[model samples]
Target: MAKYKIWVVAAATLLLLAGCTSLPGTSSSSSSKATKKLQTTGKVTDSMYEGVIDNGQYKTSQTRGLTTQQSNTSFDVKSLESGLLKLSKEQFPTSKYVFQEGQSLKTAQAQKWLARKSKTNTEGLNPEDNGQKDPNKRNPIYLQQILEQDYLGEDGSMKGMSIGLGMNQVDYYTKEQYGATFETKISKAMMTQQGKQMANKVLSRMRQKKGLSDTIIVIGLYKQAPKDSLVGGTFFAYGVSKKGSTTIDSWHELNQENQVLPVVNDEKAINQDDATAFNSFKTQVETFFPNLSGVTAQTHYEEGVLAGMNITVNTQFYSETEIMSFTQYIATAADKYLPRNIPLDISITSAEGMQAYVGRASGSKGFTTHVFGSY
Candidate 1:
């Protein structure tokens, strides 16, 4: 309790959350010119944001429908943006590069490329339909949406670009006209191959555009989890187009995973050690608090090693004193039971709203606690 930092929010009704989400972009590709400034942070968290010139205005992504274009699950949508940034760090380090919403691809061209490549729409990146309604004969949509992130130098010029291709792990469609819906299970192997092919096509298309002939592009292949999944998907592979080149030099495999805590079945493909720690943490925190509704966690891993976790604690908040005490107890339990080396966020909620938040960054020894008095 002495070491843990506490931030008490005194709002009576509205507890404003801190993170700033990337704003939706316009359909037109318009450039902006101003003084170049870099956005810096102490540590990169799940909610890292670019420093904006003004809070009310942000540089818009050139393409529209960023939120509506992809899977229904918010997990993959966030995964698409954060996963691409994490993978892009290999090529574009944060020390020198500044983050910005992409301003190159237009919404019209993006829509055209996302469509199937048919006689009328030759610009489509997807394959032509085989004129068959059969699931086996019909090609599954490997590409769901395209995400672009621009990196600029200290001078505000585009030094590099990161692209995320939101691929489908399972394509849900109807067999007949307004008939029963069916699922087309997409394998990771097929996704990998198709993603690479599509990445190259995207690069080629970009190179054809003006002022992009010599830009460096990093592409990440993300396989989104099904809409019903509790956790988001991970990036499977990534590649870098060398400077002034349109094609990727080589593809590198990225092994990242997200597993829900308190694994229900023995058949799950997650780490048992992480499961044990997470379960133990859950038991330690919720064991005495019978009033707590439920505790769940989404564990993230990199190459089989436990990386970080996002946990949710549900309850009915009746008193602020109760919240303060409960938050401290959970923070203590988290410190003793959870992995101390990785970052973790614990969000306390109730039927009313978010009651409090507790978080610890990677490599940090203490947790920062926030109790929202609005509840």
Candidate 2:
């Protein structure tokens, strides 16, 4: 069985945007002085994990398992960091990859900053308003920090370079509203364009950096939120020395083949089985803990095989120890009733915070659970 780890970061306050905006193109002629300012501005944090890839081989085709951390504001940067490190090692082994993390400014703050910089009227713009007249005209703001790290050769000469870039677009509506086919398609297309523009801006900035004429720049787009699931956004890589750029498709794209399957073993029968099992589990939870507000379960299948199961429970009144016990009970029940080899993600949200558990059935009647989230 593959061991899937859940990486959780502290949740920031969610800032809502009323509309989307066209991302502006960045100028490549900005002085090296400007590049230095870009590197110094914003809150700079140390790399979560950084070192040479001692494994000797990068896992390009490995399937990343499901995670419990959903996209709250933007794409998960921790996951992106992990992916970029692997890609840089594979594509530019001798080059040093420097990843400087960047964060999105609050909607109001960003609007004011943009208005002051451009000397334009940005009045009457509210990012938290979801009732905007035209959804297509709304543009969210993303502020990026640009920095370069050089890989030096034995003779103290610059061999190669890598730079980190970040951007985000706010989701105006909830996931339920985004479920419509047309809406999802339009949103994805717009985000993809925004991502491309942001990548170009990073490239332009990299060009301004001193002594980076021949370098490999890796650009990462953070996931923007107001989404239902953890799977959010995409990433891109550019080789300045090679004059080529490639957009790395995410796992969500790779799993598209499993979206639909032929009706075998009676689709309705399987749904009924899952519904019955889930209902029974919910009943047990409610019975054991009367304080639980509700329990909801949703199951997903691929080619008639159980692919995933999501359970959300309101844990407003449970203690930490009690929640842990409840999670174990649910895992044991899942192992008994649910199909094997599929992931089961349970989210327990309360006034304090959120706690998530990822459980997978193992040996005969055995289940393994990995817990995540701030709570």
Candidate 3:
């Protein structure tokens, strides 16, 4: 039997409670420096869906399929343990999950996996036609088809993506003997400089406590292209399972409860020194995790900040050919219209060498972009 399967839309209503989930803001709305506001009215932003599932709509829809065995009900602690064991062993066989004596897998390892799965499952609730009108607004463009593939195991459960930004917050869902609830919040100041530091720290803690090994897919967006766009700087991450399975994924971590929010860096409000400081931190992350293929960065707008700047740096695997094409595109664009350091809100950067900074970082004859540390 297939290890993974897709759950139908009917599962949505049965699986989740009736509540509105605050999704990530994808629109690059125009906002002045002093006053910034998000584009709220249009399409429902963020990966999660709103309202209850429409059963009538599901039956009439030709696009989505209904899997009979899938169950949307919340899992109990016992079921969570069994399901997680099966999932962990099947999905990550090489890196076995080693449990400590007297520790409950459901409370720790299983809880982590389920929380991640719930986040991914929420993505299914979005009406299919959302981004059809505007393709550019779609998250992980060119990667959605991969997500359609089967990732969830059988036993009526779906798998969600768990990713975390290096900020101060951690978002997740859990149920104890008492009750079940979902949580999200910003990270503490001492955790990191700003943003979502709790995610990385939580993941680290999980790895040590539950023997969970993560293959991160990092995504970073920027207001302007760096010096190079090809090898080093373009920000995006892709996942390739060792079993040779490939999936389009977001830049997040499992330990962080898989909060799917775009990490938008505001550039207009900060000075060059501060921008460079952020870049330096990014460089450190890139250097630490050399396995990343390349990061895809888009020059998106931020409402309410000074013509605000938004940037992202992701971790994932990509073929060298794809990286080359992305890099060249950025370099060509930069050469045509050179955006100055200040008041510059552009995508990608110029390359000084023939290699990319993130991938192998080696190539003598091609132009390469700086992956991290260029602001």
* Per-model TM against the reference: 0.85, 0.42, 0.18
The sequence of per-residue lDDT tens digits that candidate 3 reaches over residues 238-312 is: 222222123322332121100001124432422333344345544554565464444333221112122112223
Clashing pairs in 1: 25-61
| Pick by lDDT: 2 or 3, better one | 2
Ranking by lDDT: 1, 2, 3
lDDT scores for all predictions? 0.70, 0.39, 0.25
Better of 1 and 3 by TM-score: 1
* Candidate 2 vs. true structure, TM-score: 0.42
Cα-lDDT of candidate 1? 0.70
C-alpha lDDT of candidate 2 relative to the true structure: 0.39
Scored by lDDT, the top model is 1
Clashes of each: 1, 12, 52
lDDT of 1 by residue, 264-294 (tens): 5565747877778888988887776778899
- For candidate 2, the 10 contiguous residues with the lowest summed lDDT are 11-20
How well does candidate 2 score on lDDT at residue 145? 23
